[model samples]
Target: MSARLRPLIAALALAAVASLTLGAAPAATAAPAPKPAGDDFPHPDLRLTYDATVRYRSEQAAIADGYQRTDECVEDPQLGGMGYHYVKPAHIGSTDPTRPAAILYEEDHKTGKRELVAVEWVVPNTGQSWPVLFGQPFDGPFDFEPVGPHYSLHAWIFKKNPSGVFSPYNPRVHCGPCPEGHAHP
Candidate 1:
């Protein structure tokens, strides 16, 4: 073939290949789930190891460090778990969607003292906001059983979750000093 014809033909061939490659890609069904707001809305990076250097160690320490108990502590006998809900100071109405701002104490069954088991990120949207976290869509916020209906995700930072790391509850966690008549194996 002629050199001039060869260059023209190659250019055309490259353009066609590019178009075909681009067009063959499958249409995206969903966008990637968002990450923690990077400095946009600030909160403690709960993914960090919980220790002396980190803020709170126990529920009391969490409160001493300005975290507040969100509800009266409850004994979750089914999982042998106790969950103490505490929210950070600035984790209020619609700030960072991925802020690690809520603290859940997984009180030891034998000790009866609160230990930092997980760090919770709350969105406070509605049950409809379950897809990204709970893997299903609904009408209101994602609900962790025994604590119903709140847009949140939990990372077991100090402890391990038999269910999952990002799961709402840990199947192996224990809530000691359970309520009256509620204790069982």
Candidate 2:
């Protein structure tokens, strides 16, 4: 090749390569983003929900915000405990993750103190399909007396659950044996 022609040819090749790169469409099979760290939430909605509800760690704060303790302290010796469910009737059937219908509290047997452990979303089963949150389905269409048929999901955001974060029950939760003849206060 002639010396003068070599430079022009190299310039043409470079221009062709640049055009191919700049004009081509992006790859369709590009890899999805990496998963979040183990301690971090995979969903932004879940993280928002956690931030909104973590303030309920104070039982008084929860009560002041219209959360009322239900009649029973739910516990099952074999299956595990759901602790005391403090529910806000007005918030039921809410689809918003940041607005949970109930907050769960675990009681310390000896001290008679309560600690917030989880948040729950409840939707009345009006024959509709179960609501899904964070890609998980609500647990039931269970009929329980006054509540009738309902679907519920629990997220153990404040407490670690060996059963799983979304599991309905936690073995670590306890209803407790209240002092003397007094029931769990």
Candidate 3:
């Protein structure tokens, strides 16, 4: 074959191989589909808040993350318990869903075990608009003691709240029986 013809043939062969290689390449793998929000978590906000706060399911984890347990365990004789509050001073008056001002824990009277059940956002009322989260408004502009007039919202993500996920009190949660001298606050 003529040298020029040989060179032209080699170029055509290289081009064909390149084309075949490119055509045979596997398609890139697609990312897995995200889970759909279920009845347990009807909104993306709730899911995101859960994802951010679930790590604090243990009291120690919450403490390590800058939460300090309040001396009192809050409960209502008729409304049920709100559990022990572990507050993070820096997060006070925060509206950020991921940065809750308090972590709530329910104590097992029998086993003496503490389990984190909820997260709360609190902002003092200065006649400002009430803080809202997950499409629901904050629960107060009323006096809550020490803090005086404030608005608060709770998210019971770690544990199911029968009173409603955002309710201030959970019938299932308890500070357990108050100690001999320690009364339920």
Candidate 4:
């Protein structure tokens, strides 16, 4: 082959190889599916509930922590009754040592249905009472079960005195010598 022609032919061959190599690379793998909803952290077998009212309070905190969406806490009026579901993301810690952290559930107008949806530990200082500004202009029906077993404080929002301060004397603190049936386990 003539010298000048030889160089042209080689350059064409190189371009063809480059095109084939570019086409052969695999497309980037799709991101792994998001952690499945409702999967318990640690394990699923161990679960418990604190005060029904307190459970509701912790859910409010989870919402305030900017961990979950505010809309998740909105009552589902179409459920024939008010129902709110608290969803805790996987990274949030668990309140109960035995179970993964939990989400909160309050069935509107219903008693004895207050519960925690355990996924992992509930974060500290996440709980706050009504009249406390968390988000925009929130006046609260804030209620929650105490963080169970993991700490001494029962549920997040304990009752304050009629004077509007939390007191050891206040009837809301349910630990030692609590009023009849106020015992938490």
Candidate 5:
């Protein structure tokens, strides 16, 4: 080919390569919105209910029950168990006696027996509602530990919030070493 034609050919080749590279580049993905800060935490209408059974009795029954319920519901099925399930309330309501409430269904994994565990109701504030539920493992007249290696299961119910999305708390949020044997605070 002549020098004049060769220059045009090279220019076209360069343009083609440039167009291909640009087209192959991935489009930028939008970043997720940041979470609200402090009391500004996004409070959306929510209700959660579940059943709970205690395997080991603790002084803080509510805390223990909540932990167990959350764990079981969120358990991974591939890891030899059913994972956590998020349930939406059948109706939108409040924490007041007149409003619908959330419920959790808990069971003793070992005995296969089930019972109601916790109840949460949403109370409105400035047009938005926040979740306030009775802590886990209803404390009754009796407090006892598990006899063997048994686990508790529960079904938690909640009201779907348009703005509220559940994301696992960041483990790096804590500074010092976790409490004794505990993995993350």
Candidate 6:
């Protein structure tokens, strides 16, 4: 979901800071955010459990699992690129930032359905350290503010968000329907 910005440069800075770690993230092969074992929840904020496939799975599976496509897509390819919010049904209540009820995906323009890119937790409330929140040392910068009224945290687990691992908006991410000059990200 995109929102009004404080001009492009400043907005990009905020998104970047939110996703950045104190140091460069380790190589992708490191596998920092491993799925929980048995029934354990990954973070304190998360309210539900998920399978390993949820980490970097296909879009078809995510839709089958209940996520829905939305116009609230973000793009921040500047750093690397966080994708867009492919939100879940309205029935999915606001849950913890530890485990996202919804998912994030990158648009596959050629195919149209997009690809699973990342996941997040949009809580009605805010702030938990990066390490404690997602069982990793800052996947992305933590974002207290997002497009909607809620406090959201983005975790670019599957793909690296250029804004930062946790930056809510991806600078390079875009939506075809978003009217021009309206300012999103």
lDDT of 4 by residue, 86-167 (tens): 4445633344433223343433222543433222233434354322111212222324544332211112222222322211
Where does candidate 2 stray beyond 4 Å? Answer: 1-38, 177-185
* Model 2 lDDT per residue over 9-60, tens place: 9999999999899778556687853332234654567777777887687888
Weakest ten-residue segment in model 6 by summed lDDT: 123-132
Between the candidate structures 1 and 3, which one is better when assessed by TM-score? 3
Best by lDDT: 2
lDDT of each: 0.55, 0.81, 0.79, 0.34, 0.32, 0.52
Q: Candidate 3 regions off by >4 Å? A: 1-39, 177-185
Per-residue lDDT tens digits for candidate 6, residues 1-185, read 24555477687897788668634677667866543322233454332324433533667666676666666555444433445666654423334353365677777664686766567654332344333345543333333343333445565555444555556666545555346656434
TM-score of 6: 0.46
Better of 1 and 4 by lDDT: 1
RMSD of 5: 20.0
Tens digit of per-residue lDDT, candidate 5, span 24-103: 87556757422222212232222211112222122135333333333344222222222222223332233332232233
Instruction: Encode model 1's per-residue lDDT on 35-110: one tens digit a residue.
Output: 3212221225332323331346646667786777764554454543437778775763322334456777766666
Q: How would the candidate models be sorted by TM-score, starting from the highest?
A: 2, 3, 1, 6, 5, 4
TM-score: the better of candidates 3 and 4? 3
Q: Give per-residue CA lDDT, model 3, range 1-185, as digits (tens).
A: 88889989999999999989988875567564333223377446777777777767667788898999776888887888888889898998988878889988888766887877788998999988767878889997879777788899988777777788888998767666766886544
C-alpha TM-scores of all predictions:
0.50, 0.71, 0.71, 0.21, 0.23, 0.46
Ten residues in sequence with the least summed lDDT for candidate 1 = 34-43
- Alpha-carbon shift of residue 56 in model 6 (angstroms): 6.5
Candidate that would win on TM-score: 2
* Positional deviation of residue 49's Cα in model 3 after best superposition, in angstroms: 1.5
